[model samples]
Target chain A: MAQRAVKQERAVRTREALVQAAAEVFGELGFAGASVSKIADRAGLTLGAMYFHFKSKEELAREIVVTQPARVRPEHESEGLQHAIDITLTWAYGLAEDTVLYAGARLVMEQEQFNAPEENSHRQWTDIIACDLRAAQAGREVRRAVDVEAVARLVVNACTGAQMHSSIESGRADLPQRIEEMWRVVLPSVAVPSAVARLEFGQSRGRRV
Target chain B: MAQRAVKQERAVRTREALVQAAAEVFGELGFAGASVSKIADRAGLTLGAMYFHFKSKEELAREIVVTQPARVRPEHESEGLQHAIDITLTWAYGLAEDTVLYAGARLVMEQEQFNAPEENSHRQWTDIIACDLRAAQAGREVRRAVDVEAVARLVVNACTGAQMHSSIESGRADLPQRIEEMWRVVLPSVAVPSAVARLEFGQSRGRRV
Candidate 1:
């Protein structure tokens, strides 16, 4: 049991190191430019060890992309649920321009390093956010008229477009601030306006968005 | 006069070489990954000549970005006057993935690499479309209640998002078809239902949607 624990610890460390290196490589080189050799070099790992943990670069990238939502706080999640799905999505919007998030996103786009299965898996994970929005609409926290799938797709696209533009066009404005404002604006279209007002005024203190 | 003509010729060559090089580098390395040396090498030119013309990497990138809208066929100057403008802009909905337009847009986002005054030019271009939509509404070509600006932004965002995602996601699905269909569905909100019908049926004459 002690030996098993030791191996597990080593494996976790290796994985952390790999993820960190992925952010760096993807941040600088984008998904296409980053290679396994380069990422391994960045992480100070050998090819054999990288293979031991991850079957391929795609696996590592998907692992990172799938793991990104962990940054959302519990409070944010519950508040979003109370108000509507946009509020929850807004929380993740904060991470749009994050180096780690960008890298992980690029990895999903990096065709060579990963394959179709990995890409579809990431797409499925992305669809989860859309699913949540649809559920909120079904719950009547969001409007019934709007198409939740399209709105969810739009939300992700806006997040990505704004993130890329914000990163490359810095000094013009604060990205996080802009995103929050956008969320505030777009949220009304998807949200139950009364619910939002209630949350805004603290009328529904115990409610979920 | 001869010497001046020769100088102009050299300048044109340099300019073309720079655009071609920037496109190749930007396409593969992404905006952040590309450098002056990489572009210069790609163009088979010395760094000095590149600097002589562009002065900075940002300048070269901007030059490429500004020339991108020609692909749109200058809807503003079309022969159909205001009606043509509407048709032209509408036609562009299907051309969202045009390489030239995407490249130009990418350059605008890479504002750090192309800090020319026109860096935020896309905002105005988008506004131009919005204004045109408003004009159409005012002219009774559209519905009075539609939010022209919102729909314009939605269309632009949808196009850009589709392009970027499709480029990476391959089999990412056809967004233009979806977007065009969406317009048909949404037209009743802003445009006269008859106009929407005309858009669908080519207006009884030889006109085409």
Candidate 2:
């Protein structure tokens, strides 16, 4: 039993290494440009070992896309508007530092290359944001006049644009600033006047909890 | 002289056909995947004719990127906040109908594949929005406290995000609707109270003059 446990643990570690290497290659070279041998070499694993972990590059890409939001850490201790802001701020910083999220973002945009039939990430984000906005509305943090669903969708779309622009312009070094600006411009339409004044847009908010 | 004029007109027509064909190919296959021969064949022109108009694929891509904004038709008959709104509405429609703008938009996103360095489109967009906001401010159509540059950047970024999501989700069928939602969310921060009520977000606003 002890030997079996150790073997399973080794398999998990190898899978992780392959995931990280595949992310780096996919992030740099895109899905069509990336190759299995290149990913295995980058992971410092034998082809046989890599094959044992993932059957094909498409599987690896699907894994990355499906599991990416989890890897980016969307859970926040805060709730409502602040929660939504923190989630995006966290995402901006994550996109900057984490290869998995970066590659996942690229794959999400170029999803026509793969055959994953999952719910679109944009709708997923909209649903997440809408949930938070509903919470904010219950708490009186959000304005009654604001359309919760529309505001949520707008936030997701705006964040998508801001992150893309930041990546293209500054390699994402300015993503936090862009997110902060986005909230400032967007909050007036969604949040109550008092709530807007109290909410934070600091870069420190994005640091890992 | 008449014969010479006819030859010049034919040359102009051939160049236009080549540009249109190249845009379609680049839009569909991306810059790296596109071939000069394929572009010529799509245009129903010989390779020698294509070479006469464009020396290389890189040159064609550069031409597309440099000239896309002009092709998209940013010129607006209105002024102030309405003008800014009209410009975006027009763009949303242009992206849907104009192959050049559609391909130009793709090339702009994937520009690392080519080498053409002018001002970044985002900055150029920001400047255009700022100019419009300045005009709006001069007429008291924008709020006094609004930061024109920041708000302009926000609009550009939001539109970028909205257009991308629209493309991914519905093949841009809902782009005008998305842009309308963007304005509803963003206008409160930048436009004066009076101006906000008067703005239009119709899909018909995107139609040609």
For chain B alone, what TM-score does every candidate structure achieve against the true structure? 0.73, 0.90
The CA lDDT of each predicted structure is: 0.57, 0.82
lDDT of 2 at A78: 83
**Residue A63, candidate 2: alpha-carbon lDDT:** 85
The candidate maximizing TM-score is 2
What lDDT tens digits, residue by residue, belong to model 2 across residues A15-39? Answer: 9999999999999988988999999
DockQ of 1: 0.23
Q: After superposition, how far is residue A44 of candidate 2 from its true place, in Å?
A: 2.3
Show where candidate 1 strays beyond 4 Å.
A32-48, A77-99, A105-122, A143-145, A171-173, A180-192, A199-209, B1-60, B74-99, B105-111, B116-158, B169-173, B178-209
Question: Highest DockQ among the candidates is held by which one?
Answer: 2
Model 1: per-residue Cα lDDT over B138-175, one tens digit each:
67786666666665644444455544555455533444
Model 2 regions more than 4 Å off: A74-76, A115-118, B74-76, B115-118
- Model 1 reaches an interface RMSD of 4.8
